[model samples]
Target: MGTLRDLQFALQLKIEELRQRDTLIDELELELDTKDELIRRLQEELDRYRTTVSLPGPSVVSAAASAQIEDKQRAARQTVISEPFIPDAATLAMGSHKSCDKNQKSSRLIKAAFLKNDLLNLNEEEVRAIAACMYHTTINQGCFVLQEGSIGDRAYVLEEGRLDVTKDGQKMRSVEPGDMFGELALLYDCTQTYSVSAQTDSKLWVIDRKSYQTVLMQCGLSHQAHSVELLRGLSFLQSMPEDVIMKLSDHMKECNYTDGSYIIRQGDTGDTFYIISKGQVTVTEKKPGREESIVLSELCERQWFGEKALWGDDIRTVNVIAVGEVTCLIIDRETFKDIIDGLVSDSCEEVQKSNASKIKPDEDPFLVSSTLSDFQIIDTLEVGEFGHIDLVQLKSNIKHIFAMRVLAKKLILHNSQREHIRREGRILMEAYSPFIVRLYKVFWDVEHLYFLTEACLGGDLSDLLKDKGNLDEYCTRFYTACVVEALAFLHCRGVVYRDVKPENVILDEHGYAKLIGSRCMKKVEVGKRTWTFCGTVGYMAPEIILNKGHSISADLWSLGVFVFELLSGGLPFDDCDQMKIPTTTIHGIDRIEFPEIISKDACALIHTLCRSNPLERLGSSRNGAKDIQKHEWFEGFNWDRLCNKTIPPPVIPKVQYPLESSACALYGEGSVKQCMNWDDF
Candidate 1:
């Protein structure tokens, strides 16, 4: 009986052990499933790259796909060049081996480089002199490390787990250990080039500029010793200064016509040069047997075409068609000329002799000219209870025309209110670009305060949004960047632009947009943490409407709504009163809804911008709207292409003077309080 019991006990122990093994397997499977889901999401973002094209020309491989192919080629080239780094066969034949202790020490060193951020504050000789600084932090799965629009200051080295880099919400790759990402932003000081999300719980080290500079000063580092390293290091050159790379990158443009597409035809005089970004295009000559199309080149990614006719004043060399989708970048002749001119001239280095003669400010050298001393009466454009704008001819033609905005006396009774108005004027002036009116002077006349700026002849963006049909992504990108840059500049100064609406955005002839004078006149309560609900109703972000503390992100939200109006030719959320009779009900409140028709990129951008949570709004996230700028929709824009230079202004067709009468109606009525402006102040 005892022997039988002992055998039974042993069987019971075996059964329990098997059960434990099964549970372990189940847990492992669950973990694998979680990891897979993270990978899939990352991959989904990568796939968003499909619609990306080289532009004008179509291609067999999408831009994202081509990038992958290039990466593989570069990787293979690296392996071949690095073969010399391996131990020699003679060493192996000698039976020499690395000790386990040595291997352990090496592993520790790698781990120290990969899993630490304490290095950020330390500028040690080793870290500082090494030309690459290592810093790391942990990231959870689904967290995006890098995003499109925000500028990048560092390049990351993946230490553990994986990451996915995406553009336009598409995943470009599953980057894993030993992979480096975000070098482009660091190299250029421009916005983040792509969005990066962790595919798993990740550990990463980022090499920042200071550390990198420190490393480059090393005496041991030389071009000959690190030729392969140099190439890898220079991968960051994709973000090189636009002037340095534009010509070479321009050479990468491929131009071709698919069967259905038109290549240039007769009598088109506009200047444009096309380079194929992808695919084969056919050229046809109409003489005899030549009538049939002949393929000049099977233009794939990186192939150059369309230069001979563009360089000189030549007409179309041959009629062309895209055999397939052709992707190409079309450089307008004017812009091309501008670039070539910049290259040939030393204008960037040569400042005018007149500029050097001016006295320099001991501090804040950016302060150019001082405010105007006096001004005579001018023709009033609009006078209201809040403020007024006047059309004024400055002292000289070189002075240009200026608009004067005066705050209403009633609104400035409170000393705090007067101070707030002054601050707001500065903020508003900074929040818009040169496309908008450029604020040149702000001061107080005897009876009136003045905010003066360059006048735009074309009128406000609100009118354009309403009158023009739906705006395309191309136009929206052009405007959004201008406004965002304006906002960024304003925010950096610690000024909050509480008011952002379509009515405030004025357009110039060159399609450049600007913030008009209305923002300067709005009433502002001093010492308040947040402004009152001041913006036009439909354009206000929910947070602002709720009187939550407004910030730079508020302007971003307004921009989203503004873009929606531009694209849809109407508002995203319509006025309830507009529909006298309601159709659908939400929480027993009847509502009307309309189908949306806009590019997916615009829609996504709007959705992000108009989020109810201010934290999630565009430019407020960890990475922000920089990612939005990098979307596939904005593929062809050379961001550096538009900075600090005068853009070809939007084409304003000849409209009879007094546009308000032609489009909707021209009428204005408002009252100013009894007290004079200076007295109220």
Candidate 2:
């Protein structure tokens, strides 16, 4: 009996050991699955990079550069296929490799030289200490050193060999030995702007975010003092706080210009403000009807120019020439504006309070339909010449999606432009059509005017055309019918849509067309016409091009051009030289040669609608949109169903219930604000 009991116990022990082995096997399989998924994602990214880099065009990349790129692509593929760095079971369990102190002194030397340009004030001891904290590593050729959009933790100094740098899959430049890359990642915990890949076997020294921040903190006081000293001499920046000056310095870049180079030219759009850091510049103005430029002022180091552009139209009023080899610290328009806004917020507390009180219970009837406090801005969808279109949601219990159009009040307040804004608001409110983007409300604060309207997730027809090339006849007819109905509604209401093109037509989630852009919609009496040399280059009507009086007929001509562009992949009269478009437009539809691929019926209809004489245009006749609707090109089309959005659309954009980032321009988290004072609006 004792022997039998001992044997039973041994059997139980063996079963327990087998169960333990099975559990280990299950865990290992799960880990392997996870690694496999990671590898698949990496492979997809690599493929996309290869495809974008290999796109053929002389304009895109030189022949020699193209060959080099192809060779790199092959090397990368071979690396992936032959020796992919897959983590083994033991390595996975242990995590990443430990950092060693090998090659420390050499790394310190490389880092010092690499950071010399950016951190000019760093002493040898400070630079060595920063380098001592970095880890040294070597990678084989075709390895990705840093990837764009990846969470960046470290900056690298190349010790040996070359690396290629790319942004959005386009090669920007190459980094040679002793050069540093990925410094921006050290400044903030943001995604990398560019990808760095090893073009050959490379050695690098990398510093993590923690070490970089420590160094910056240690040097902060001196950096701030240096920035403030540089900025104090400038008149416009004199009132700025030390912290603001320090922040501005972070965004500023040093630019060098040779002698006699034009820093800025009169009548050109100014985009950057400059502070002379190391040389002299001369500001000049052209005397009326004179060839010679009169020197207004000669500016030396610490002096500035281009401040007026930040506050207004940004049109340069004077010419600036580099007197010698000049080095300037430059700040772009957006950065300057942000800095100014911050300073204004800090200094203008009293102004904001006064403006707050000025907001009475009663306001302009056309401007305020609902209080500005009721909506929350989600994200900026698009930036326009006059304003920005933002994705917004109602703050009420039932969340509603909407797009808020915000126009700068300063731009609208100009004497010549004020009427245009007023008219746009009025027309949008009065003109109600399903085919047009519906306006829910209009309001304004001290700094900006706002229009709340429906959000179109499918983007614009122009973007769609670019993606799909030219559309099929059925798809073109479906979209055209929607536009025709919208135009018919506008014309009958006595509103002339001066701008009519693919950009002006937006597509909803269901792919239905909606006409937007109220700026060019003007109300006119039946027989009268308005003369404005406005509208896009390629789509401009002959009457508008010739400066002849144009009314609703101009919209018809634009529509015809738009249809042709949609049917053919190219524009009817487009040229590389913009100067030639005006002459070509005035030469009229007779010069338009239709591609053989376009159907005969479509060609005939385009000719009828794009007639040079407004009276002879198909839609401009007594029958109006009815004549175009009955044309052979749109034969058997269901106009009523299309208008009602019951007809199945050719394309439907993928959308989530509230919204998706793909549908709009994504701003950083916390960049958008729900509440704004009158001054900040």
Candidate 3:
């Protein structure tokens, strides 16, 4: 019933949204009609002026005169596009082995030498920092820089002399000075497929995976924040999706200009965009026959120009010169073109609203209308300390199956969980979404309280993950999307879901994930906070763990942990070195090293959502879940299909029917003496 109601509500919302859009379109059309009149008058005036003044060429009027360009950049810094420490995982077969302290190398690095390694895509400052972290080492002649089939921990840059890369003792390639080798090992623990040996007494620079990824993540976070913040402030791109903005930011490069250096010169053919990030830059135009340029305007930090390059206007008409030392976030046209296709066109909710029956195929079974006596107990699904959840079948219709949560009233009273149980029951009864389990009905007797809900024969994500080890990106994405929908549904109703994890997600007959019953959710109004310090360790957000008042952002943080764990098979904050980990805060999440197995895109999403500051989390902005849904990682995802259940789930399970049994018979009305406290149910 809840699902049915929410679908109806969703339809109403979609209709309203479309109505608003239609009104906006009408208003825009009216504006265009006015603009057309102005254009006709201007054209007449232009024709008169052209005949009088003898214009340079024949007159032409283009239809594109009123169309606005997609004023955004298409370039990222070539030196550091993303996760520069590792190559594209799909391109390389990876292996890693740990090396002891004795195997670690140290040697002198030539400060004056220019490093020529394709593997390191970093600016001069990053390169220098990496160089400092790299210990100098020497390999004796004929010594293996790495042995075939041996696991390794560090990557090396050839500083002096040379080495041989061989397979089966046959030289396959030569390692020259400034070349990088064994770089993949720095990302993960894997065995070498081949061998590298010093052809001479060679000097090498070595940096481990931990050091390299840490430095890059630190720089990437700061750079990502600055670029994204700058992009977010621009007005023309304001309506662009957040994911596209993040994509542009990732591909954007930082360029520096000293006094009088030209960022973009007049009359030069250019397709690059720039955002002034530091100091000031003077925009100037060189008039015809003028020796010196006239200053048009000055742009400072957070200001941008040159977006015309993203469109067809590739020629720079004016020079942008640095007033002093100026920094810019720049992107080229090709990058913009590559990422612009990801722009979200329209909401598909309207299509869903058009469906005649906006309800799941499995509508409410007769059990919701029937009394308790019409259902017979099948078997106990889970035996908890409070009571047990049992599978049940409708006596009148054996085909209908459901799960009954039978909690002992006495136990709930003793545990002081009556209010929590009441809240959960109320939420489950009121909430509705395809991503959330539908609670059919609530009942109470002298001994136990019962919560009848939809039975998910496919089991839960926790069990599925246990059986499959860990999910691939495809499965992880699907599950994360489902969870996000569930959380969004709950959060929109002013509910703060503090418990968000795989164990709470169950897959239904169609294998689509749904958030089941939750006890930790609270009805927090807008801008309100809850002080309850409850959540699973490692999965809880920093605010919850610190007893800091929290809102829905905590759920988003846990969603980050859910995504990270599903992809990498472990919690981000969890590690063997417990002492080294801080207890008060998770502010050092930037320092956590993600396995190379997780894609850079996935890591980027996780980082944004898992920020220490709740307000800074990706979805915590005013746009909420739309920020996360439009993340670049979820590009091309069909949210409408997910809502409509038209998309097949990542996993499907064989359905199992529980046979009728008497296990729940012992927990009937006469079983307990203390049931007076649960009268509300």
The number of residue pairs in model 1 that clash at the backbone is: 40
lDDT of 3: 0.69
Instruction: Please identify which of the two predictions, 1 or 3, would achieve the higher TM-score against the true structure.
Output: 3
Regions of candidate 3 where Cα sits further than 4 Å from its true position: 1-365, 575-585, 658-681
Clashing residue pairs found in predicted model 2: none
What ordering of candidates by lDDT runs from best to worst? Answer: 3, 2, 1
Question: Alpha carbon lDDT of residue 366, candidate 1?
Answer: 23
lDDT of 2 by residue, 236-257 (tens): 7677666566557655776889
| Whole-model alpha-carbon lDDT for candidate 2 | 0.67
In terms of lDDT, model 1 sits at 0.49
Model 1 TM-score, all chains together = 0.38
What would the per-residue lDDT of candidate 3 be over residues 1-681, giving only the tens digit for each residue?
A: 235644554465356556746755764664565455445545544654564666344332332332222111101100000111223333211211222232312222322232443323345655554566666566667666677766566788787898999989888999887677876554344457788988887877778766655554444445667888999898878887776786677568778889999889999999999998898989999999999999999889999999999887988999998999998988888767756653432133324433522443454646435766667766557655456677788867677788888777766664456666777777776676778888877767776788788888788887777678789999999999999998877776668877787878898888999988766766875434555545555677776543335688888888988998899777777634331122422554687888998998999999898887786788875456899999989999999998889998888888877555333232343432322233455
Predictions in order: lDDT: 0.49, 0.67, 0.69
Could you give candidate 1's per-residue lDDT for residues 187-258 as a string of tens digits?
224346578988887766666543343233231122112322222233434453443342333222334455
User: How many angstroms is residue 477 displaced in model 3 relative to the true structure, after the best TM-score fit?
Assistant: 0.2
lDDT of 3 at 588: 45
Worst 10 residues of 2 by lDDT: 76-85
Q: Tell me which of candidates 1 and 2 scores higher on TM-score.
A: 2
- Give the residue spans of candidate 2 off by over 4 A: 1-370, 413-416, 659-681
